[model samples]
Target: MTESQDLDLTPRDADDVSVGRKRLRNWLIMGTFTAVIGFVLFQALTSAAQFYYNVDEAVARRGELEDSTFRIQGTVTSEQAPDANGALIFTIAYGGVDTAVRHVGAEPSDLFEIGIPVVSEGHWEGDVFQSRQLLVKHSESYEAENPDRVEYDLDDTPGYVPDNTVE
Candidate 1:
């Protein structure tokens, strides 16, 4: 074909060009959609930080834990005598571990006794934890005489007869 008398790159039918353009547009649109979807999915899977903290986690992350109010789950470690009428004192036991906590408030509930698991919420003060609230877990063991299992007079007042009596 002679130079100017010759080739037309454009398709003879406008419809063909339009169809090709439509296909290109569709490809572009699909690419944008795919990118957006992938980004949202990635964010969903890898966003927030999680922690199942224990005594060790707290002790290990002591600096971070000092001012931040978080969770501490432990058992009553050793005997803690509540001040004549002041705070409830005990230690939490968890993860083969324990942490001392002193809770000051009204008289503790019946469940607040030795050897019972407790969940306390509060801030750690120096070496000891000063709990704002105390929650006690029930005992798993059974006693035949005391089926009710409501048995403990920690104060051991003169008139108090413990439900669990010695034979």
Candidate 2:
């Protein structure tokens, strides 16, 4: 009787094998789906990251930057008058190297004059950096205007106002 009881316990039914296979298949499906989702997320986040380079570095790495978005920091070395289509072409230089830039959107800010530092974000095309966005960096110093030096025109109607109030 003990032997008979042992045999009954040792033998597994077909139902048990079927249940085990189903559980393993379900777990494999879940794991595969999770891995695929994680891979896609990683790819998207890495592609969206933008790296910045100086003018000299950009010129040196022009081959790698082609068709890729990047940020460049430099000074406006030269500028050409706007074309009939309002496209502004200019050159920015840093570390003694220059990169040609073309902007087709709105004109640069008043502070975007020559020799001023600028950070441009765009992609590198053939022999040029096509920038869609331009940022001008200015000094952080602030100076208040003198209130004592007020100018009034005698020959014209006087409606002038000073910037600061004198104590």
Candidate 3:
């Protein structure tokens, strides 16, 4: 056979080259898709995660955390009243440190009051925490430990007297 015939590429060689190109394209597409999915999941998880801190820690780290949203836990130490924009303003204390919070959005549950522990979620606005969500921390053990102390309206449960009621 001549040198030209010996070096000539066959139809089978062309088919193999086409198959190799297709495989590389598929791999590239799959890699791009996997990368995109990974990036989306990372962003979703990171954005949903929030750092929790006590009032004292939050106060101490105010400079570092001023721009980030986080959760602060403390006992309500002041009266809760509405501000000019109808936001509830109050003070919370933990570990002898106090921080003021201005809560906007939905009102907290009835359990929210002075002395109650609450976790507020928001970022700092100046020296005050601008909370968009407030969660009251309460114990379920109160009803279990003191069944008789549970207060019920006289109309709702007739003849059931609460422990605080005068005889």
Candidate 4:
């Protein structure tokens, strides 16, 4: 008869009950960290988003024009004349005041006549935005993209060549 005596298995460790509390603390820490990271990522994405603003809108919101890219839409204001290189000189008035824009490149589109809107890309330097590219804003209309409408006249009839043809 091996001794089969009672072993008092009571109060093994008083802090053993704290496991549940520790888990709750861990969960709270993890959750708070996740929430903070998620919020920061959302704000960065929002701030880096593309912004399309008119000249007036840009002028009114100079604070919004920090070191961020922007697409400003406005009519190319007529100037005294073109520059020496034939690049058009004009002012893009966003709001009541106009800032000079020097477009030293190809001529504006045929439709880029005065009073027609054009979109320019640039960052604001002070109260002025130095445009790097100009794009004419087209009206809301669609045209069929048939081959006939294409400007190029190319031979699309594929005359197949063997793999050995290109040496």
Candidate 5:
């Protein structure tokens, strides 16, 4: 029988060991980068999700939502004319709860009337919801109410002034 020679398969020099360690380190770094990128993507997607709260729900969760920006949808009950500073103060109610809101920067839409549904976006400050944007929502199919006008003669008035006078 001929003599058998054994060949070692393991790393024989420091360079071989270093190369192996370098490959391991690269893999670890790439895995870490992938994990970080995935985590950031998840956070970005979740952070962009917006939520809307009703008046009653908002009032109930005021403490928790005080610092968060959200939308509140409700029916306008009463509103006051803009103050000297052009800030409109209105009250909206839903589910038997009323929420006071203060809107600045712009006037409410013409369709924003009492008893109409509106959505306000802002955060709560103390007990009031401060908003810079207000959306008035109307049904897709809307019909205007037409009422008959009463015919009245100006001569019936005790004292009447005419815009145009002819000799």
Candidate 6:
């Protein structure tokens, strides 16, 4: 036979081609799935992470922080009644430095008051810190020891009388 006739020019078996195609397809699917999962985890972690700082440290780094969201811990040195828009304005102090905060959200619990420590979460706007959430810090032991102590203002509660008061 001639050399040209002896050469096997016909295509390879169907099974060989199909096996290569299936392997490539599986790899593509796995790669896409891994990429998607990685992206989702990155987003969740970044959004959940919150940097914490004291009032004095936050004030010192105000220029660097700018509009970034964070948490500040300090004692509530002063507080104002709800404003016209129902925002509670207060001042928190730490290490002898004070930062003003404008809280616009649900009213804080009875534990929130002047002289109490708190952690405010939000970003700084101009010279004041605009907060959406407030966390009050109180000792459970203190409450247990002073069960009779009135922590909240009585005048604010309309028609509510204290049973422990002397008639």
lDDT of 3 by residue, 41-75 (tens): 89878865654788889989999986788999887
What 10-residue stretch in candidate 5 is worst by lDDT? 158-167
TM-score of 4: 0.45
* Model 1 residue 29 CA deviation in Å: 41
Question: Which segments of model 5 are wrong by more than 4 Å?
Answer: 1-51, 148-167
Q: What are the lDDT scores of the predictions, listed in order?
A: 0.63, 0.72, 0.77, 0.62, 0.75, 0.77
* Tens-digit lDDT string for candidate 2 (1-167): 67766565543655887889989999999999999999998987875454467788888898876788888887776678877878788877776667788887666789887666787888888878898888886767665777886553322211111221111
Tens digits of per-residue lDDT for model 4 on 1-167? 24556656666554766777888899999999999999998987875465468776777777866857777776555444775766565665434445556565556667765445578777777755766777887768677768767452212212211221211
- Where is model 6 more than 4 Å wrong at Cα? 1-51, 143-167
Model 1 Cα lDDT, one tens digit per residue, 1-167: 58878777776676877889989999999999999999998876654233225665665676778866655665554555567867776665555545677787555578666556665666778867777777665657776776787765433322122342212
True lDDT of residue 71, candidate 5: 87
Candidate no. 6 TM-score:
0.58
Model 3 earns a TM-score of: 0.57
Worst 10 residues of 3 by lDDT: 158-167
Clashing pairs in 5: none
Candidate 6's C-alpha lDDT? 0.77
Candidates 1 and 6 compared by TM-score, better number: 6
For candidate 3, the per-residue lDDT at 91 reads 80
lDDT tens string, model 6, 70-142? Answer: 9988777667878899999988777667778999987778989767778888999988999999998775544
Error in Å for residue 1 of model 4 = 68
